[model samples]
Target: MESESSSESSLEKSMENVLHLQNSDNPGLILVIAPLNGTNYLPWSRAMKIALCAKDKIGFVTGEIKKPSKNSPMFKKWRRVDSTFWESNGPLLYNIKREISLFTQGNMPLMVYFTKLKKLWDEVQCLRPFLVCTCGNCTCGASKAIADFDEDEKLIQFLMGLGDHYDHVRNQMLLIDPLPSASKAYSMALRVEKKKDV
Candidate 1:
């Protein structure tokens, strides 16, 4: 009986150690030394793993520590630490935006340049998607308006990245009453390129 009781006490102590939070451990605590910029993913991840291991929290990320029931005492703390490790959208979004802003159609063919820009734009759209109304009774044109605005923004960015050789085409495209979608703009530029080649 005494042996069984001692084993039970040891198990409880182990559980307590797993769930224990040091005074410095909090949601706001920065775990790794370097924040994860868009680059340096491997090194950042390695450092983060090391830091989490040091804190006895690596299981939160490695899936060794499954989430307990909502009523369990460890639930909130687990959630807080887990969220901090996974919440990386802000840096990713910033990197995408920066890439879009810096993009330019240097010596590359129009098709290649447009394809690259389109990929970056698609990433941005996926990360920060527009909200669409799903209710059958919706009357406000807000969703369509938002979509149009997003397309227009993409069209402008596409045109802005074109070389000076495309100045006339870009200006003509801008003069349209409603801006063309980015794909339509790309098609227009492509036609111009074919003519120039001829």
Candidate 2:
């Protein structure tokens, strides 16, 4: 009985390290991934692997990680994904990891994914040294587990009356996405591009 309880405790601790429930005085860094929706997971998961393998200074925080899993009881304390992930995606969720299928290369998926993500995080990485950038190996870290830009989209759109935060920036954006061709994905702001005139 004691061994069984001990084993559970060990598992809980390991999960806690992989997915923090809240910010600590020194929470290291946050790697915010998108929600576990079909459209968001692939790119976000790729971003997660790169961040995890690339840096010890940062960690991941995702809405999907909070959902229930086989060992749901272990993460009973992780019910808060907002305070935990610096943004909320509703109640705790988990197990979606099993549901995730590795995204393969076609048109060089990595090539395409990086292009979009880098365009988004490039500036953020360099400008905010203390941000996700500079804190990780690529010398740019932080965007690892950012709230799904899509999820944030709804909140931002719904709260349009709350005075815009990203609109000025978003409005100026002409739909050009950034690529992570370097193979190393670091968390940074974004690298916007001027739209090519048709």
Best by TM-score: 1
Q: Give the worst 10-residue stretch by lDDT in candidate 1.
A: 79-88
RMSD of 1: 8.6
Which residue runs of candidate 2 sit more than 4 Å off their true CA positions?
21-45, 52-77, 81-198
> Using Cα atoms with residue i matched to residue i, what is each candidate's TM-score against the true structure?
0.59, 0.23
Model 1 residue 111 distance off true place after TM-score fit, in angstroms:
0.3
Candidate 2, residue 83: how far the Cα is off, in Å: 6.5
Q: lDDT (CA) for every model shown?
A: 0.82, 0.38
Residue 78 lDDT (model 2): 47
lDDT of 2 by residue, 96-189 (tens): 2212112222343333544543333332322222334445564442464342442343223222221233345444332324322222121111
Q: How many backbone clashes does candidate 2 have?
A: 34
* Residue 42 lDDT in candidate 1: 65
Provide the lDDT at 60 for model 2: 34
Model 1 — TM-score against the truth?
A: 0.59
